[model samples]
Target chain A: DAGVTQSPTHLIKTRGQHVTLRCSPISGHKSVSWYQQVLGQGPQFIFQYYEKEERGRGNFPDRFSARQFPNYSSELNVNALLLGDSALYLCASSSATKLFFGSGTQLSVL
Target chain B: QKEVEQDPGPLSVPEGAIVSLNCTYSNSAFQYFMWYRQYSRKGPELLMYTYSSGNKEDGRFTAQVDKSSKYISLFIRDSQPSDSATYLCAMMSAGGTSYGKLTFGQGTILTVHP
Candidate 1:
């Protein structure tokens, strides 16, 4: 089975612009989570969605939002991008026991 | 202090040597401990996972967790160049929103020179 997959492998945006990143979870998986990994740091949880309902959210600001589709795919939308927002955005899908992650979308805010 | 503390070591070791990676966590409620390996520009994959304390071994890798000290370690035997990557330690609590959410350490970079 395929692992989690994310789109727009790379993206660049202006400081004040907006960005939307997409992720497709593995087949049969019903939970999806988003995390942000800065250049020299580990991934920080952003949001988690299960059964198309928001299950949990991290300390990120309201500008960062996410939603899960009926098919368990997810999208992370970040607005008012700042230079600090430049990082690799990772998407993970979970089963009962483990999480499968995608290669991630690299977003650069200039 | 961060909930999970890990030395961000660009730890370099010669091949066939033993490598040890460690993390100290502040959360006593965390019951599930996990280690992940991440290659450059890729997402992390689970290396070892254990519940509560005790040690678990797989192949040349061994994961040890000490709940009393709030410390966890990953040991690699006969390290090879392929083992070069960032090793991350993550933990999750037993109940509430934390159940599905994992708190991660900064990660230690390991490079095994051939």
Candidate 2:
């Protein structure tokens, strides 16, 4: 069975632009979460959705948003991107509380 | 202070050597401790997880949690070249609004030479 899959394996955008990254959770999973990992740093929590409802959010700014669909697929959108926004964006899915992550999308904001 | 702290090591070890990675957190409420491994330019893969304070062992990997010290560790026995990667420690605690949320450490990069 497929674990988790993310879209646009890589992405690039300019400051003030917007980018959306997609992810498909493991089949039958109900929880999907997003994380951002900058160069030389660990993944930082962004948001988590369960049953298509926002379950939790991290300390990220309002420019970062996400939504989960009925099928447990997820999208992470970042607006007004800054140079600092360039990082590896990861999506993780879970059947319970333990997370299974995808290969992730490498985002570069110039 | 940050909730979790980890040493970012460019630690080099020979194949078949034992490897130990560690993290410490200030939050006493954290109940779940997890270790994740990330390859270059990839997402983290869960390696070890332990709930509360205790030890959990999987094939060749052992995780230890000490609530008294607010510390957690992951040890790999008979490390292989394939075991080279960044090891991250994550913790989960109640945020007053959610049941589970994770805080991650900086991660340590390990290189095992064959």
Candidate 3:
């Protein structure tokens, strides 16, 4: 089966702009989570949605938000982006125990 | 201080050497420990997962967790050049408001030269 898939593999945005990243989870998976990875750093959790409900959230600012659809796909949106927002946004799909990740969308903000 | 701390070593080792990577965490509630491998400009892939404290081995990789010491380690035996990548240590709480959330350490970059 295909693994988690994310859209717009690369993106470039300006400060104060808004961007949306999409993720489609593996078939039969109901949990989706978003993470941001800065250069030379590990991924930081942003949001996790299970069954379309917000199950957990990390220390990110209000500018970041995410939601899962009935089909188990998810979208992560960041508003009023800053240069610090530039990073790779990763999406992961999970079963009861194991979690699988996508290639991630690289976001560069100027 | 970050909840999880890793050496972030740009460690260089020759092929056939045994490599060891470690992480220390401050959260006592973290019950799930995992190691991930990431390549340049790519997402992290799960390498090993362990719960509580014990040792689990898979092929050339072994994951060890010590809850009492709040520490974890991953060992790669007979390492190859393909083993060169960033190794990340992650932890997750058993339950509560933090369920399903994974806390990660700064990744350690490994270079296994042939």
TM-score of chain A as modeled in candidate 2: 0.98
Encode model 2's per-residue lDDT on A1-110: one tens digit a residue.
98899999999899999999999998998888898889998888899898888989998999999998877899999889999999998998876658888999998888
Q: How big a share of the true inter-chain contacts is recovered in candidate 2? A: 0.59
Best by DockQ: 3
Off by over 4 Å in 1: none
Candidate 2 local lDDT, residue B86: 93
- The 10-residue segment of model 3 chain A with minimum total lDDT is A92-101
Please say which candidate is ahead in DockQ: 2 or 3. Answer: 3
Cα lDDT of all candidates, in order?
0.93, 0.89, 0.93
Task: Show pairs that collide, candidate 2.
Answer: none
lDDT of 3 by residue, A1-110 (tens): 99999999999999999999999999999999899999988899999999999999888999999988989999999999999999999999987656789999999999
Candidate 3 lDDT tens digits, B11-109: 999999999999999999898999999999988999999989999999999999999999999999999999999999999987644655899999999
Report how far residue A37 has shifted in candidate 3, in Å. Answer: 0.5
Error of 1 at B15 (Å): 0.3
Write the residue-wise lDDT of candidate 2 on B1-114 in tens digits.
Answer: 888999998899999999999999998989878999999998889988888999999999999999999989999999999999999999887453343367899999999999
Ranking by DockQ: 3, 1, 2
Which interface RMSD does candidate 2 score? 1.7
